[model samples]
Every structure is written in C-alpha cells, then in structure tokens.
Target chain A: MMQIVKPDFEFKKVYETLYPVIFRVAYRVTGDRALAEDLSHEAFIKYYERRNPLPDLKQTKYWLIRVVKNIALNYEKKKLREKKAYDKLQFKYPHFTQSGEAEFIKEETKSFVQKALNKLPYNLRIVLVLKEYAGLNYKEIGSILGIREGNVKIRVFRARERLGKIIDSDAI
Target chain B: MCPDNETLSAYFDNEIPSPWNKRIADHIAECASCQKRLRQFETIKNYLHEDREPSFESSLEQLEIRLAGLKPRTERVSLWKRRVAVPLPAAVIAAICIMILGISLIFSLTRSNLRTMSIRRGPSGTTEVQVAAPIEDLELLLKSLDTYYLKQEIIITLPEDSLFNITGEAMMFREAEFSRKRE
Candidate 1:
C-alpha cells in the first residue's frame, strides 16, 4: 500500500464514479432524496479530507461507503429528534391546511413501499442497503459497521425477510 | 446435518468457505427444509434490491459548486465540520482570520529588519516592546487587541490653602511698610 500524498490528486473522477452508488445507499436507508443528498455530500467531504490516510484507492472507496453509512445513521437520529419536537409543536399549536387527513392518506398510499422500508429497523435497513445498493460484501459491510461478517449476513437476510413480509402484509 | 440459518443465508451471497460451500450446495440439493429456506431467501433478495432509488440532478450540481469554490483543504474541512449547509459566512470569517494571522506572522518575521525600536526599561530593567510600526499597521494591531482591555483607578491630591498664609503675611508687610511710605 503505497502512500498517495499528491498535491494534485484527481479526486473528481472518484467523486463522479462513487456519488451515484453512495447516494443510492443513503437514499435506500433514509428514503428521502434531499436527506440522502445531504448525507452523500457530507460523506464525500469527509473522504476529501481523509483520503490520504487510506492505504489505497480501493480502501478509499470502501472508506467512503463506511463514512456515508455512519453519517446517514447519525442523520437519521437527528431527524428523529427533530420530528419528535415537530410533533410536539403540532400538538401544542394545532395548525392544519385544507390538505386534510384524506390528502395525507392518499399521499401515504403512493409511498407505501418507502414507508415499509423506513419501518425496518435502522441496523437491518443499513446492512440491507449497503449490501444491495452499495453492493458491498459481508466482509466489507462488516468492516464498515464494525460487526462480524456472519452478523452482517444474518441482518441482511432478516431485513429482506421483514421487507417481504411487510410488502406482503400491505399487498402493495 | 442442517447448517445454521446464517450459514444458509451466506450461501445465497456465496460467502461460505471451501469445504463448507460444497457441503451446503450438496445438502441444499437433497434437504427440503434448507431448500424451502433458500427459496425464501431468493424471493426476499430479489425484492429488497428492487431499483427504487429516486434520481436527483442536484447531486452533481452541488458537488461541482463545492469543487469550484474550495479555497483550501484545512479551511474547507473546518468550515464543513461546523456546519453542512456550506454557507459563505463562516468561510468569510475564516479568511479574515487567516489574513490577520498572516499579517501578524509577517510582522513578527520582519521584526529584526526594523531600523529602530524605542525600548522602554521597566522597574526591573526589562525592556518593553512598544512597536514603532506604520500607522496603518499599528491600527491593525490595535484592532486585533480590541478584546483584552484593562481598567484602573487613581487619586491626586491638590495643594490647598498653603498660599493663604503666604498671602496674609505679604499683606501685613504691605500695610506696615508700604502704607507708611505712601503716607
């Protein structure tokens, strides 16, 4: 693993190639395009700063995936807290648009699959997205999440099974 | 013998090792329970990897904007770590700070080049660096030191009424000698 400490390192090519893949994993995990974009941008920024520490180009990409997943997880927690505060606000100060519950129900119908995916626990959801969308193997995902390869396999399987059950239950 | 659920799932991804991989393949071929589980795994993997990630054009645009505007690696990371909105306010503040610091560094480095420095010896004979910089440079240094200010109080007593005694004696002398001369 030769050190790549070049003053003119070409990071643009890597960014272009990796953005789509990282974005998909983040989007799949969080189920929001805007949030995913933020998460993806954050991961790339982190990679830009820490690219030298990684041993090689391949490790750098893996490091990007790992950082993206962790950032997404942290983003999810922060978003959850914001949502709780928002719900409390809504309860205290009841403001409703003419959009109404019926319109909300209609909108929910359109994103049923997404809602189901969001329902899956974050740990399972993260492993599933990284494996399926990020296209990382068990060892790679394990290295990212700091878990065992066997555990990664089991989580991925459980995530898929739970997703299938949810989809079947909803018949969407 | 039946493999564990994790091992069976690993087979779908072909994560099983050498001898175990062959054994699982042979076992799944003959065993109905493992075969059923394998089918379930396949069904789920197919559904879970469904291509549902929404497309956003903003990804590349945002990246381009950042790459175009990147000033320096250290400053970029510091600004970004504090906030991800990528606002220019922090960058502006950071640039101002760096400019100030650079000027200070240059000032210190060029200290030896100054033709004259008025050194004031304090009570202990230690010299104080009252820098004789250009007015603009001095103002800049003063502005940078705006935060730390010290306050003090002092009292001064004025000599009062000692002149009254002298004035009284002079009047007495005038009344005695000068009055007689005038008369």
Candidate 2:
C-alpha cells in the first residue's frame, strides 16, 4: 500500500537545504532573478504536491531540478513566441522602443556570464547550467534532459566554447 | 593525431576513462595548444560561477506560506481524477449517450409492441371489447378501466350482454349489461 505523505518537517528541511541550489539553477537558466524565484517556487510546489516524498533528499533534489527544467523550457518557448511578436511589432513601428521597465529588469537581472550563457543555444545552455550551477555530472544532466551521457559532454564543451568566444568578444 | 578540444574538455571534467584519461593528461602536459584550450575551459567555468548568489530569503518565506495552505490530496482522489476524470470525460459522455439511446430504444420498442384496442357495438344489440395488449398491460388496463371508460368514447346502444375478447388468449363475456350500468 502506498502512503500519502503531507509536507512535514522532512519536507521543510529538504526545502531549506535545496532551495539555494534550485534558485541558482533557475536564475542561471532564466537570467532573471524574479522569474527564477517564480520558477523555483513552482518547482517546489510541484514536489510538495507529489504526496509521496522521494526516498531521500538526493532524489528529491533531482526531481525538483527536473521539474524546474521542464518549467523553464516552457517559459523559454513562450518568451521566444513573445519576442517574435514583439520584433514584428517593432518592424512595423520603427520609432517604438522597448518598455522602460523591461529594459531595467533585463539590465538589473542579467550578469555578464548570464548574457553569454543566453547567447548559447538553448540545448547547450541548459546542459551547461546543469553542469555548473546545479553541480550535476554529465551523466546526471543527461538523465534529467533525457539524453545520453556522451551527448551531454559534447553539448557542455560546445557551450563552453561558444561562451568563451562571447565573453572574449564582449571584453567583459 | 592530437586530441580534439571536446576530448580535452571531457578530460578536464574527468569523464574520460582510465587509459585514455592518462593519455590525454600526458598529451596536455606536453602540448601547449591543448593546455591553452583546457585553461580556456577553466576560465569559462570560473566566469559562469562568478555570479553572486541571489537572496532567496523572501522566496523561501513565500514558498513556506504557500506550502502551509496546501494539503496532500489522497491517492484515491488523485488517481481517480487522473485516470477517470481528466482523460476520459469524452468516454464518460459517450457511455451516457449510449445508455440514453438504449433506454429510448427500449421505450420505443415497448410502445410499438403494444397492440391497439377496439370496442364496437354488434348488430345483435350487444357490445364487444377486443384488446391485443400484453398480459401485464392488460392487467393495468383492467385496473384503470374506470378512467379509460370516462376518457374513451364508448357507447352501448342496448342494455344487453357484452363480450370481452383478449386476442391470443381466452375470451370473457359479462352477462350484465354494460349500457344499463352506465345509465
């Protein structure tokens, strides 16, 4: 028989222990602190709603990280669609500039490295973020992304190469 | 041939296996180009890590508050919704439609199966009632004969005997005059 568990002391402990790392992964992937916070909360809520806690904290962390990856992928897709629509509008209205608040948010939230990471393709960026920010090995990242370990290694290397070029060119 | 940058990167991450890892390590020790590539990977890794950790205190508080109000749904309810409610609404509706269709078909069939009833006055100054309904319906009709007597246009011209004929069954006659009783 499967037991349904509530969010108890064990859950709170896991949340505290993993929140920082989860937030870091979200932020690095999204490059926006507010959006990262939202995504992190969404991930944890999903975990809490699972009703059956993973056997241990390590498994819980992996589950939460996987959830965050899925949520962030959806967010990236929506953002891409919005950007395309905005670009079309911009083309029609040449004098229109980006909203000041949006500009401010981007400037405030995006770090130099984050900007470089964003320049990499989504696939490479995701693997690299998992590798560096989530402290996941290539095998772990591959497991989360549903790809092979070898594919993960190549993506991480390619991400680093592109990121290095972006940083050197930007001279930041 | 020299190991490509990908192999060096994998070597940097210690993902390469033993003999190849040893070979790459020896090659990097001797090769300046590979060493520079490895250093560049290191620099990039360092750059990625340099971003200061954002404060999560408020976010954690918000999550805690949200989690406080959330109750764990029972496995039964969750499974029910997931398996039966969410994906099978169409199936449920289809089943309901089929049942309704079946019930209506039965009702229509029963209505069609019921034979018509005829009551006529004979040339011998007697009345005859012919019924072709089922046994059950005949019982009910006999029970409700008083209401049907008032509703149906039944007339007997003579105060004589009346014959009752149940088709595909026995015939019964009442010597009492049905017209005399009505009068």
**The best candidate in terms of lDDT:** 2
> Which residue segments of model 2 deviate by more than 4 Å?
A1-4, B72-183
lDDT of 1 by residue, B87-164 (tens): 699989988999987887776566542222243333354534554443223334334445332121212122222211
DockQ, in order, for the candidates?
0.15, 0.32
DockQ of 2: 0.32
TM-score of each: 0.60, 0.67
lDDT against the true structure, each candidate: 0.69, 0.78
Deviation from native of the Cα of residue B128 in model 2, angstroms: 72
Candidate 1 deviant stretches above 4 angstroms: A1-9, A51-55, A86-112, B74-183
lDDT of 1 by residue, A22-134 (tens): 88877778777777888888887776666344556578778888787778888888978977877787788789344468747744643656777888999998888787777
Model 1 gets an lDDT of 0.69
Residues B1-183 of candidate 2: C-alpha lDDT, one tens digit per residue: 579777788888888999899988888789888888888988887877776767889999999898888876333345434533445788889899999878866765555444547555434426677656543344455546656565554532332333233222222222223423544
**Tens-place lDDT digits, model 2, residues A39-73:** 99999988777756688988998999999999999
CAPRI-style grade of the A/B interface in model 2: acceptable
**TM-score for the second chain in candidate 1?**
0.38
